[model samples]
Target: MSWLVTGGAGYIGAHVVRALVDDGESVVVYDDLSTGSAERIPEGVPLVVGSVLDRSALDAAIRDNAVTGVVHIAAKKQVGESVEQPLHYYRENVTGLQTLLEAMASAGVGRLVFSSSAAVYGMPDVDLVTEDTPCLPMSPYGETKLVGEWLIAAAARAHGIRAASLRYFNVAGAAAPELSDSGVFNLIPMVFERLEAGEAPRVFGDDYATPDGTCVRDYIHVADIASAHLAAARRLADFPEGTALTPSTSDAGRAARSGRWSTASSRSPAGRTSAGHEPSVTRQVSLADRARELLGWSARHDLDDMIESAWQGWRRRHG
Candidate 1:
């Protein structure tokens, strides 16, 4: 089956595209190259440069490529920027997805693997957040993701589309130096930038209520993220036709750790020390039980693996 990977040139998207291709699946890349580089896309993979908002472009790519499924990964994902430009976030993340769905429906494409975020459960007060955690998004970016899930669910119910919304936690690392995340918006890259500048990494808000007084989060490897997409895509491809699959929530993350600095310190190439204490924030485990039972999938990489791989990518780009 041919899969159209939207944003296939971006950090995580590029990894997903490679994984799909390595599995011997026919793949096509649809990206605008705004934040993504065309070079990241593997050789021989057809890349259709276009925005998700452009229906004509999306239609042409889907029809021409004979796309049977879609892995929607394109989005404006900055939290702070979403706060400053809520409309743009909604337009790009929410409206853009709507446009994609409409084009997919019109083209008779019925399978989707949506790239969602843990931000939908913003500031969970539980000890371990599961798929049932109540969604209370803290930022516009989070809101857009939550809304995107809603849209997917609605479309699935109405159009008999097979879909899964993978709510990813902190994604880090790289399968290769070229595939490493280049943005400094994430904690790993942010710390790498600070260390490269010969400065101490800043630990944000160490005063949060917890055991050590800093926030805890789950970080997962980018390669694992790509594997998850492949698993989900395969599941949808083989699902019985006309059977409506509810848009279920699937979480993906590593074991929870306290403080961005604590997580960063464990993997810092220079072995830098962290100043913040660990917080009591709820462990954001990705609740992979459903994925395991349904898709027979689970993460294989750990924190050290993620950090070391990410650091290698950082050095490759910065040096």
Candidate 2:
């Protein structure tokens, strides 16, 4: 059965489509071309021009493509914009996901890989965040993601749908120049924008409790994100029939921080080491560990690799 990838023409979605295709899986691109570019879609893949909000379009695509699974990557994801336009974010992200879930249930598409976010854990106070961390989202965008996860979990329990929600941290870099993220909403691109204008990238709130007074984030490569989707899809497909996949910490722990961030502070050149904050005996191991154990997945790229690859893409577009 083929996979229906919503928002397949977008930056991250396009990467996911490519990864699925490379793995010999049949894929159909479903996108509305709102913030997504049609040109990002590869040859030999069927592109269905539609939105998740369009129930008829979603139904038609799933039925026509004989889709057995869905990799949902479509959603409004701007933190600041989500605050200003909370209603709009809810309608597009949460409501649209509900529509898609309904269409899936009707069409008998039982497997899903939902694109979630680290934003779900707003300003985490823990030394290491995991899947079971407290979810106190700070913005509408984050709330939408958490709600989406809840919806997926509920749907899975009620309808026997096998699903996985991948809570991605900061995603950066690209597999190719053309596939690089064009949006400036993310940190890497934001930095690129400042540098292109001959200005230093601003580090907000240097007085925070972090080691260097700057925030530390677990940045994963977009390519790694794509592979994680494939891994989750395969795991779901392999599950026994009549079994509903619960919200496993396996999917939630996909993007754990493997290393410390380097900073310009006097405390240490390379901030606190992973050894500094040892894993608690009572607390669970990292999400990355769970991912490796359950899905055979691990992130191979580091921060420097991500920055260098992103810089190449930036120069290709803005130079």
Best by TM-score: 1
Off by over 4 Å in 1: 208-211, 238-283
- Against the unseen true structure, what C-alpha lDDT does each candidate score? 0.82, 0.77
RMSD of each: 3.3, 6.1
Clashing pairs in 1: 210-280, 212-278
**Span of 10 residues, lowest total lDDT, candidate 1:** 242-251
Candidate with the greatest lDDT versus the true structure: 1
Candidate 1 lDDT tens digits, 1-319: 8999999999999999999999999999999999999999999999999999999999999999999999999999999899999999999999999999999899999999999988998878776667788999999999999999999888887887888888878888899999999888888888778766666666655565567555667778889889988888888867765343322233344554434443454434433445553343544554666667777778888888888898888879978
